[model samples]
Each structure stands twice: as C-alpha cells, then as structure tokens.
Target: MGEKESEKLLFWEHMRTPIAPQHPTLPKLLVLLILFVSLTYLVYTLKLVSTSRACKDAPFSKTIIAVNATASAAAVLRRGSRETNPEDRTDLRHLVFGIAASAKLWDQRKSYIKLWYRARDMRGVVWLDEKVKSEENNSDTLPPVRISGDTARFKYTNRQGHRSAIRISRIVSETLRLGMKDVRWFVMGDDDTVFVTENLIRVLRKYDHNELYYIGSLSESHLQNIFFSYNMAYGGGGFAISYPLAKALQKMQDRCIQRYPALYGSDDRMQACMAELGVPLTKEIGFHQYDVYGNLFGLLASHPVTPLVSLHHLDVVEPIFPNVTQVEALQRLTIPMKLDSAGLMQQSICYDKSKSWTVSVSWGFAVEIFRGVFSPREMEMPSRTFLNWYRRADYTAYAFNTRPVSRNPCQKPFVFYFSKAKYNSTMQQIVSEYERHRVPHPDCRWKMANPAAFDKVEVYKKPDPHLWDRVSSEEKLLQSEEVKGERDHGDRCGYV
Candidate 1:
C-alpha cells in the first residue's frame, strides 16, 4: 500500500512538472512559425492600408471638357500674332478651338459660321479658343503656349485649303491645350451642330467629379470605321473626355500625328488614340452630330426648352430669329380687346352663311381663326362625350357668348328660352316608360321617337325579389355545415 501511495505521488509530481521536448529543434520550430505568421500579418496590414489610402485620395473619376473647333479662317490666319483683347482674356475656363487661315475656304467658312452661332447661344457656357493666325502682320504677340516641351505650331499648306485635314488638327490641338483644366470631364464638337445649352448645363451640374469618362452621341457608322483592337469607339458628332482620358489623348497625339496623319479627318481616330492609351470610351446617348434640321423645331416646341447651345440653319435664317422674337413679344402683350354686339352679330351671320359647306371648309375657317387668336396648347382630338353632351346651340348661346345678358338683376331669366323646345331629363324618362309597356302591333312597325319631345314621364323597373332570400339560405347552410364538421373532428379526437 505504501508503494502504491508513493507511485500515485510520483505520478502527480510528473504531471506538475513540465515535460522537456525530446527534439531540441521543437521550440525553435515553434518560435519560427509564430514569427513567420506575425511578419506576414504585418506586411499584409501595411499593404492594405497603403492601397486604401491610394484609392481614397484619387481625383475625380471623370470631368466634362468641351472643345470647339469652329473658329473663322481669318482667326486662323492671325494665329501667331493674334491680338489678345484685355476684355477677351477671361481665365480660359472650358472652351478650346484651333484657328487656321490657309485651309480650304469652304471648310473654314462653315466652321467659322458654326462657331460664331454656338458662341452666341452658349454665352454663359465655359469654352476655350486657340489663336492660329500668323504673328508677322499682327502687332500683338501673346505668350507662347507649349505642349510636350515643344512650341505648338498650327501649320497648314496653302494649296490644300479645306481639303487639308492637318491644319484642322493643328487648330484642334492648340484649342485643346488652352482649354483643358485639371478637371476630369471633356467634350469635343463642331460649330455647326445645335447643342441644347440647358440640357448640357443640367448634366454637368449633376455630374460627380470622380467617375468614368462618358462620351455622348455614338453613331454606328463611326464605330465601324474605328478599329476595336484599340478598344476605342465613342462615335458621334461629339464626345466628352475625362481628365485621365485627356492626358491619355495628349500622350498619344504625337505618335498618332506621326503614324496616322491621314486619319486626322475623322474624329474617331483621335478617340482611337485614347483607347490605345488605356482610356475607355463610354457609349452614352445625348451627344447628337447629324444634320438635325427638324430637331430644332421639336426642341423649341418642347415644354421647358431653354437657351439653345447651337443651331445650324443652313437656309431660312430670318425665320428662326424673327418668328421667335415675335412670339416672345406677343407673350409679353396683355391687351384686352372687347367685341361690340354689332360685331358679334356680323361674325355670327358670316359663320351661319358658310354652314352648308363641306367639313374641310369648316375646319379650315376654324383653324385660321384659332391660329390668329388662340394658340392651342398642343394637338389633340376633341373629347367625344363632352362635345355630344353640350349641343352646338348651347355652345353658341351660353359658352361662346361671353357678354352678360342684362345689367339689371331682375332682367335676366333663371332659365333660357329658345324657339326649338329644349330637351331636358324630365321629358326623356316618360318616353322610356311608354316604350317599355307597349306590345308590338303587327300592322304598325315601331319607330324610335325623340324622347326629349315628351315631358313629365316616369319610367321604373322592378328589382329581383328572390336575390336576398337565396343569399340568406346559402349563408345558413354554410354555417351549419361548418359547425357540424367541427363537432365531428372534436368527437373523433375525444376532446368534445
């Protein structure tokens, strides 16, 4: 028994003392394992923090930059020494353009006209223009602008004229350099196209400074011409450029100018360069670049159409301005015209004299009068029910006759009187009752009579007498069955 107790005490002591590892490398192995895990965790944490900060501080994802290329040929010729009007030197905010004199006169004229019109319309919008004229004849020499550490030159061969796409590109580059801000968004468009100023302003106002670049108004034809290998095809009349996108374009411009100088005629080529530089061209609608002649009318007629950015009226110049001005002036007029009784009688006689004519004749007169006096809010068909309910006589006598019948309170009648007896609700009911009671006379066929002619007649129909009784009987039966089922279930379960 003493030996057994000693063995128990020895076992307890063995349990209390820590066991020494048989392999000396075990402790070292454990220490190394722990150190490795700690180092890995520390490295991972640092990397995560660094990545998070880098993402947080990044600039706006995209910004809208608008570039206009519609400066006059004269403006282009005076590029080198173009006078900088102290007043014209507003901090070049958001517009860019290139001017060149030696290009084809036709192209220059078209571009110039478009540019001037757009500028006039986009008075409040931000834009930039690059002077492309020669400094030789001009007295003023503005500070030289540089791109890629080189003095940018707007060069054009005199013979190539409008056919020379190189000069146009040079003008575009000069404008872009001057207009681009540190912001991310950008736009490039020709002068001839009409831009909705309010719509653009509204979009820019809501645009987040940090987001992907968006190009508006993509055309399928332009897309086809662009090589997808470059991953760029924002085809349309105009496109927006992000700051990152702009930088990418600037980087690729030199290479593109050298490699695909022939592609300069197409704006899609410039877009392709951006694509090659890893800037994505987002396909978004809103930028329209087609010859939109009819679109102007639709835009003007729109409910809240505001300032138009650009309008290209190749023909009929005075119609837009003069008509718009006249309408505006009319809107400000508040003249109150009164018609004399003699004048009303004469108008009524004239209308009555033409009553026998065809519907087209009647409609023509109505439309002419409508156009002259009242502009209908919009085109829509007349409501059939309303027209039928208010007879033409009632419309002429009461609705259209705006004048008071009499000045004295006692002189006016509560009800109107007419030569043709007025048909009212009381007269119609009696006729319906008479018809219901009549049996068919074999010899005399019944003809529908005007119920309005008769008065003080009442018509009544009997209600179904058995409906309520039948409903009550069904309800009682359903209730009784439900109660019986509940009792049966309870009895089967031995809980009743």
Candidate 2:
C-alpha cells in the first residue's frame, strides 16, 4: 500500500507541478521574427514580379525614351556640326576621282583631264582598260594611270553597249578598295568629261557626304532618259558617290552588276546597284551630259540657274566658241572662271528700253543681244541651235525647255563671245571684253535696234565671291527695274 500510494502520489505530484513558462517573451519574439521574415519574402517576391512585368510590357519607359531621344538629337547635331564646320568642308582634298578611260581614247582625252586637274591638290586615278604608251612617261601634271582589273567573268548582253561599261561601273568600288583616307566623295567620270573643280566642290558641299548620295544629272536627250532610267545618274556627265555609299557598294556591287546583263551602260549598272541599295539619283542640273550634236552655244549661252559642274561628249559637239579648238576654247573660258567660278555660266537678263532691246548676259561665257524686248522667262529658255542626240529626233527631244531658232533673221540673237578679262587691282573690278561673233543677218523690213553697231562689249564686274548668295535678290531687282527701264542701258548693263 505504501509503494502504490507513493507511485500514485509521485505521478500526481509530477502532473500537478506546473511546467516553467517557456520564457514567454523569447517565444513571442521568435514567432514575431519568423512572421516578419515570411511577410518580407512574400512582399519582396510580389514586388520583383511587378517590376519584371513592367520592364517587359513597357520597354520604352521615360528613361529609355529619353536615351533614344538624346541619341537621335545627337546624330542630328553631329550632322549639322560636320556640315557647318568650315574646316570640315568638302573640298578638292576631300574628293577622290575615278576616271573611266580607254587606252585608245586616253591620249586624246588626257588634255581634258589636264584642264581641271590640279595635280598637287587633287587625288585621282585614271582607270584604263590597258596601259597606254603615254602612261609610261606621264607628267606630274596629269592624273596617275592604272590598268583596270579584267572583267571577263561579268556578262554583258546589251547589243548596243560596249563591254567597257562593266569595267566603268566598277570604278567606284575599285576606288574604294584603294582605301583612300578622309575621302568624302568618290567622283566617277569618263575620260572625255571635263569638270569645273571649284563648281564641283560647290555642288558637293550642298549634300551631306556622310549620307548615301548618288549625285549626277540626266542626259540632255529625253530619249536617252527614256531608254535608260530617267532616275539614273549619267556617268558621262559624271557622278559622285558618298564615301559611305561607295563602301556599301563595295559590299554588293560585283554581285549587283552580275544581275543586270542587259543594262546599256556603266551609269545604268551603277544605278542598278543604287536601286538595290534603295538610293535614287540626286539629279543636279549643273552636270551636262550634252547628249546632243551641233553647236553647244545655245546650251552654254543659256545655262540653267546653277553652277556648271561638268561637261561631257565635248568631241561629239561643236567647239563651244565660234572659232577655236575645244581645248583652246576651254582655256579661254578659264579666264572668267578664275575671276569668278560661282558666277561662271550664270545668266543675268535686263532690258534697254531706249532701243527696245533685250540683253542676256551669260557671265564668264557670252552675251546675247536681241533687238526686241523678250521676257526673262523666254530668254532663260535655251535656243535650239543644238540638235538632239539622235539625228531623227526633233527639238522636243531635249530634256529641258528650248525655244526654236528664230526663222526671222532680225529676231536672232547677235552673239558676243567672251574674249579676255583683266583684273584691275586699283578698281577691284574684272573688266571683261566680249567680241562680236559676226554672223551676217539678212536685212529685215522692221527696224527696232542695231546690235551690230557695237564691235565689242565690255563688262565691268566687281569680283564677287558671294555672287550666288545675291542671285535671288538680283533676280527680284531685275524684275522690278526692267519695267522701269532703270536696270540696264544700251551697251552698258549695270548690276541691278
């Protein structure tokens, strides 16, 4: 009874003994810590998911949008800076010329190259099919000659076209392969093409050389434009490719030319590559392909309101001047060109109300005198003294506006060709003389004024570097003053 009672009492005593409170503060703090950690993890996971979703859904957030906007603005600013920086301007040094020449024509055409080519200032190579005899002893005055890579692999199916077209089309790519440094433009031309280097630079400066530009002009013949692409830059007139574009062409040009077997000429093939690259021709009216026969007087006398960048097919057309070889004529033309390149071949018109005569002055080239008053609009249009490329084609075949050669002898322009110019240092004037081109006109019953009375015309001009800048204002002044007969007087056309 004692042992059983002791065991029961001991068990009762153990059960009745209260357990020590598990340090209530410690347990309560531990539970709170665990809940805090779990709650924090849940909240963090939800926040991470929301952020990921926002990044994926709204990719261009304000920060990202701002970055893109800044990048675009920076690009525009870079372009603007490059264009405006006078030190970064496109000049003779920035141009690399690739002339497409035949060994056969090289001798005859090197003179044309020598005219505009300032060897020390220019970076150029005349790419010929084969080495010419003259190339061995080539002068430092002329561009260095190089033999073109054989293009036997390329196929040419155009019956009317010469296979040399293939080689010519690859000129820019070959030029790029030479790895010219600091070259902004790769200008391509035929051996016969003559460039006014200053005007060429002026024309090039108008465009962004960093961008892809296939700059040139259409053929003078409308049929040529129709046959070829109206959009194609005629290589004979010469064309320029931006450095970036030439590099881009170097990537795909060989493959590109292979695709166009039936294309007629180098320009078309070059244009084909440009088309593949999604670059359209940047037609600058200054480049003259001169795809016509007969006298160039009508064309040159009334040059469009742009710089005369180039002239091609000089051999095909009559000598520009009345009585000289083409080379001599160009040499003579350089006189006024040196004095004022921008004003070269730029036409200015005024009236002599006393004589009821109209005077059109082709600065640096020629002067035309009409007995009757002619609108500036009519005077601006070239007279069709030059024939179209095709003998069968009519005056309407020209790409530009052309007035008919007047059947009435009296209505014909009494021409005065540019002779000599002297720069008077004291006066700061370029005094130029233009002699009468004596083409005897039949006597007309109607008498207005006699242009033949003058043996020579003297033009007094101030050497204006900013001639083109004032063109608009001068034109406006001409319009305003012509009606009042206060712009120009007989035998003396004052600057309006």
Candidate 3:
C-alpha cells in the first residue's frame, strides 16, 4: 500500500505545470498605484483650475485681487462702503448749476434766479451771451457771472430755430472746463426756471453721480414733445447731468453739436449726444415744463405724486395766487414748501359724511369741494383750465389726460386758494387755511347741498418729511382698491 501511494504522488507532481514566483505581481501593483496617483493629481488639478475660472468670472474679482495684493481687507471693504454710504448723499455743494440767460434778458431774468439761488451755499455760473452791465450792486447775492465761450464755429441749419441753441448747449461743456472740484452734477436751466432746491436734491440723491443719468421731464404739449423728442429733457424745465455723464459729454459734445446742425433747440442737440452714449431720458414728472398759457392752478392742484422739483415758463403763466404778483405768489408758496415740500401739492381726498360732500385737498396749494362724490380717478385728472402752448391746439393735443372744466352747475367744485399755513405746536400738526375763491355759478335745483356754503377749507396735517417713502405702498393700495371698486370710505380721508 505505501509503494503505490508514493508512486502516484510522484507522477502527479511531475505532470503538473510549475508555478511562476509571486514577484511579478509587484510591478503590476506598482503600475496601478502610479496610475491612481496620476488620476488623483489630475482630478485635484482640474478642480483647482475650475475654482480659478469661477473666481475670475466673479463680479468682485477685482475687489478680491485688490484685497490679496498687500491692501488690507478692511481698506477694500471701506472703499466699497464709502461709495454706498448714505451720509455721502448728493447735496447742494455737489451740484453746479448752469443758468442760460442772455445779456438782453439778464436784468429781467436775473431776479428769478435770485429767488432760489443761494450763493453762500451753492456753486454755479450765470452764463450770459455777453458781459452784463455792472449796475448789479450786490453781485454777491447771485451766482458768479460768466460770458459763454464763442460757438461761431458750430453750424446751425434750422431756419426757424435760434442759433443761440448752439451756445446754450456748450454751456455744459464750458462749465466743465472751469475745473471745479468735488462737483457731482451739472444742472442746466433757463433763467426763467425756478428750482425748488430741496426737492431737486431729493431727486438727484436717488441717482449715483458716478454713473450716467439724464434727469428732467418732457413738455406738457404733445406737439412739442413729438416735434422735439420724447427722449429730450426740456432745458427750460431744467435737467440734471451726472458728473460722469457730463464728463463723457464734454469729450464728445462739440463733435455731437456739429453732427446736429439741423436740430431746433439746445435740448435736442443734447439729446443727440446722449443717444450716442446709449442713455435714455430718466423722466421725473415733478419738473414742469409748463408749456401752457394761463393759471397754473389746475396743474399745481393735482400734481403727480412726486416732489415739485422745478417750474419753467414762469413768466408765461399767470401768478399762482389770485391778486398777487408772480414774485409774491412764489414767496407765499415757499412758506408751505419750507414746512413740508414732500407734502406740498400732494392730493388727498376725503368725505364729509355729515354733509355728504367730497373734499379734495391739494396740501399747501388749494382745496376743492364738490356737492356730490367724485371718484379720485376723476379728481386726479387735471381740469382743463390752462390753454395749450400752441394757441391753435386744443385739449386733445395735450400730452396728459385732462377733464373739461365742468359745464354742469351741479357738478362744479367750489375752489379755495391757500391763504396761510401755521404749525400748531400743541397738536404737532400744520393748520393750513384755504379761503373760498368766489366764482359765480348758474343756480341748479339739484337736491345736493351747495359747496358754496363753506367759506373756508381747513386742512390739518402732520408734517411728514418722509411722506414719499410711504407713497409707493399707499399708491399701490389706492390703485388696487380703485380697480376693485371697493375702496374703503375712510381710506386716505384725513391727516391720519
């Protein structure tokens, strides 16, 4: 038995193939390890490259690079903060006004400039076509006078337009060349334009002076806007140019003027330049071109919900108040403007439920009492009291919607002009008085009580300096409710 087992084992061992040493597998494992390492490195390197590209495409990439290069991170943050700081707001000191007046009209128009211009607090120049006579005793009260640079080189091809449009347009470029420091805005206006300085600052502050902006308004006349441009900022109404925009304009404005010889006015030429720079008009309804004739009552009484930044064509319109000189009327208006310019001309509608009467109070201006309820929507539309700029044009030619002066005796509003306003210290409110402006109306047998019964309309309001801040939400609510035809009876009723 032992011999047979030993022989079989020996035969099987001899027949079986000999196995290779385990050492060969070491090289294969080494190759796999090398591949794994290379793959890991490639994956890590690709992730780094992707991160770098992401950083490069980021908006604050420059800020990050600046932070990395020896500049303290706090310093970089501070620079960003400085640009956005609320305290660094646009102010009068940052503005340089360019008032366009001819030496011929300087005597008459300079008085208008004196009404708003504060030489002590403002930096500006009165650009006259020629040197004004030295009869002005107190030159200190006015902006420093400067004769405009000659524009004889510029060609004006418009047969109907004044060639002085070329001169006026260059006032901005000339003002820029004066090398005034820290100027952020250049506001241009005709001598007749009366600015509400505080409100102008409020508007200018909303924009970034470092960026480009062209701020003003269109003319009230549809014909004027269509004939000139819907994109133009009317010069008479006054337009503000951001410092950056003005600088860009200074570079190309003369060339721009040359290109537009056929343009009718200074504003159109300016608009052509703005178009080249790809800027559009940023309209502010408060700046009134007032391209109309007659009393400003209709427009002022229902001013759009914004600060009244300026009024142009003052000489053309009747004095704002009855029986007062234009200058005196403005002085009276400024009283309320000083108390609360934000609330000035802001319309508020209320119901006198006891009398079943509707009262629409245009704070700081006028009040109108109607015998029956009138929709705020109707009251918001300005009454056609003023004539269109083109005497031949009718109400249909207006840029805005206007309601005809009511011919219905029953529907006529008893108007009251603002008489005086005083602060009631104990109540912490402003008590404004509006005396009834007596006008004869045809008698009607309508059952509604007459608005003429009331002699004075008294409005008590708490001076809201921040009224505009709340206007957006309140306007939205008003619009929503008006649309639903379910506006609450007490909504926007009183001072509260």
TM-score of 2: 0.80
Instruction: Return the lDDT, model 3, position 446.
Output: 87
TM-score of each: 0.33, 0.80, 0.80
Per-residue lDDT of candidate 3, residues 48-83 (tens digit)? 998788567567876566556545445445544754
Worst 10 residues of 2 by lDDT: 465-474
lDDT of 1 by residue, 305-406 (tens): 111222332231222212234223112111100111111001100111121110101100011011011112221211111111112313222111122223
**Given candidate 3, what's the lDDT at residue 102?**
90
If candidate 3 were superposed on the true structure by all CA atoms, what would the RMSD be?
9.3
Error of 2 at 23 (Å): 55
Q: Give residue 352's lDDT in candidate 1 (0 to 100).
A: 12
Q: Model 3 TM-score? A: 0.80
Q: Which lDDT tens digits does candidate 2 get at residues 281-348?
A: 99899998999998988888889978889999999988898778999999998888888888788887
Report the lDDT of model 3 for residue 382.
90
Cα error of candidate 2 at position 319, Å = 0.5
CA lDDT of each prediction against the hidden true structure? 0.32, 0.85, 0.85
